[model samples]
Each structure stands twice: as structure tokens, then as C-alpha cells.
Target: MERISRKAAEARVLDLDGREHPLRSLWASRAAVLLFVRHFGCREQAVRLYREKGTIRALGAELVIIGNTVPCFARAFREDLAITTPIYVDPSMASYRLLDIRRLREALLSGGALKHKLSALCGGFRRVQTRLDRSQLGGVLVVRQDGAVVYRHLSEGADDHPAIEEILAALAPRTSDEAQASL
Candidate 1:
């Protein structure tokens, strides 16, 4: 994986309080697992990452959830999910564009999307109403403090995300040579 682009790292997102903050701050102090969510109402991916927050932190990384909506929607998502992981909003979706996470019109009707919806329903997470773009997908990025993005998974459809094991492996310590070679 390559280091995060300066444009993406510098893209501004709003916290729940509506304050603008750069995305790089997320990994400045520690490695971070950044989950760019489809929307605030898509709880499937968010809940999955939330469940693994402890394991992620155990690897000396923080998990940050970013949604494409306003602060109110993000606040509601946090309350609805009852999770402590920091959630942010990018109403303009500039970060998504900079990261090359695209939107597919067929994503909503894809077989994988259907399977994910069913799985979320069976898991007891109800679908909430959202006005945000339904075609927009989400992605995962594992980034080190120095700005190297060790792992990146760009979603092909709604609810598509990288495996927990894959993300954890990216966060796992690597020897200097291994790290250098990956770069």
C-alpha cells in the first residue's frame, strides 16, 4: 500500500460538534482504522467495526467512523448504535473523492448488497431512513502515524468492507525491511 495522498489527508471533515478537522489528525498520534461509511443510516458496516473497537485498540490503533452526512445524522447514528468510537461527517464527500472511493449506480441492487442487507437484518440492526446518496459506497483504510496507508479496501457496493482479519494484519507490527518493501 502507498502513503495517503496529501489531498485526502488534508481533507476536512466535521466532528459531531460541527467543528472542521483534517483527516490526518486521526492517525497523527497513533495508527488508525478509518471507516468511510456509505451514510449515517448504514449501520451494518458501522456496527461491525464498532464491535471490534477493543481489538483494534489492542493493536495500538484507533477506529474512526466517517459518514457522508451532516452532524445531526452522525449524532443520531452514534446514539442509535450506542457506540463510543468517534464519528465524523463529510457532507461534501471531498475525502471520498480524494481517496478514490467511487459510487456505483448498480450497487443498491447488487447481489452482494442484498446479502449484506439480509445479514444486517438478521443481526438485529434495523435500516434507518437516510436522504444521502444511496449509490455511494464506503471503504476501509489502515494508516500509520507517519501517513503511510498500510491497507486500503475500496467498496464495490453498499455494505462491502474489508475483513477484520485483513485490517488487523495491516496494523500488526512489521519489520523495517518488510515495511520498506511494502512502500
Candidate 2:
């Protein structure tokens, strides 16, 4: 993923209710982890986010999930995952486009994809057909309160994700200590 400067990162994004808001508002007051999901139905990303929620929150960063899914699907997905993360809709995928995200076919024919598929299935995350665009890729952006993107991760494949430690470290210096403590 390319680094997004504060000047280039300003854009409008919609919420789950079709309300418009400046995307910068997410991280304007505090750090934020902007998780642009492939779709709410993608189990691997959901589960990963689900598992890491507390760690992310503890770092004093807001976790927001944006996607091309409709409002209804967004609600159901959040409920299913039992997460309170702020979810948003991007029907036109304006943010995705502006962020330069692109589809990766390798995600389909790779060992990582196979692992995630099986993991998702066994983990009880069934893929749902909601007429959403599955081909559209997703990514992550860690924005500082000043709107600078400190961390950005564009998916390389279906199961690609950034290292948790890297994300935590960027939010603050304590994550390194927290990680070592856990180990």
C-alpha cells in the first residue's frame, strides 16, 4: 500500500445509513484503524478483526470498517461477529478507488487463500451471497489524529493481512511492551 499524505487522504465516505461524512473525521480526534473490508461476508478478515478488537481499542484507536455492502448486510455482519466496531457503507466504492485498491487474482489461487477458506469454513463463517461486489479489494489504513496515514496495507491476496504487532506498534510505543509481555 502506498502512503497517503494528509493532503491526499481527504475524501468523503458514506456511513451504514447512507449519510455522508468527511473520511478524516474518523481519525480527526484520535488515531483510527480504517479497515476497508472486501465484503462483510469475508470471514477471514472479520474473524481477524474480531480477535484483535480489544488490542486495537486498548491502543486508543478507533476501529472503523468500510465496505461496498449495503446497510442491512453491514448490520447483520456486525451482529454476527458480535463486534461494536463502527461500520460504514461505500456503495460506489469511492474510498476504494481513491485509495488505489485493486483486485488480486493470486488471492484465489494461493496457499494463503486455501488456508483462509478452510479456516473460515471450520470457524463457522459461511460466505453469504448478498449481491455485493466480491471482486473489489480491501485494505487497511492507520491514520493519526492529524490525518496522516501512519500505516497502510493493501491486500496482496484473499487472506493477506498486516502483522498485528506492526499495527499496534504504529498506534503507540506500548504495543511492543504489550506484545513482549504476552509472550
lDDT of 2 by residue, 64-83 (tens): 88878778888888777777
Cα deviation of 45 in candidate 2 (Å)? 2.1
Over 125-149, each residue of candidate 1 has an lDDT whose tens digit, in order, gives 7889976877778999999999988
lDDT at residue 47 of model 1 (Cα atoms) = 79
Return the clash pairs for model 2, or none: none
Instruction: Tell me the TM-score of each prediction against the true structure.
Output: 0.93, 0.82
Q: What C-alpha lDDT values do all the predictions have?
A: 0.88, 0.76
Q: How does model 1 fare in lDDT?
A: 0.88
- RMSD in order of candidates: 1.5, 4.8
**What residue pairs clash in candidate 1, if any at all?**
none
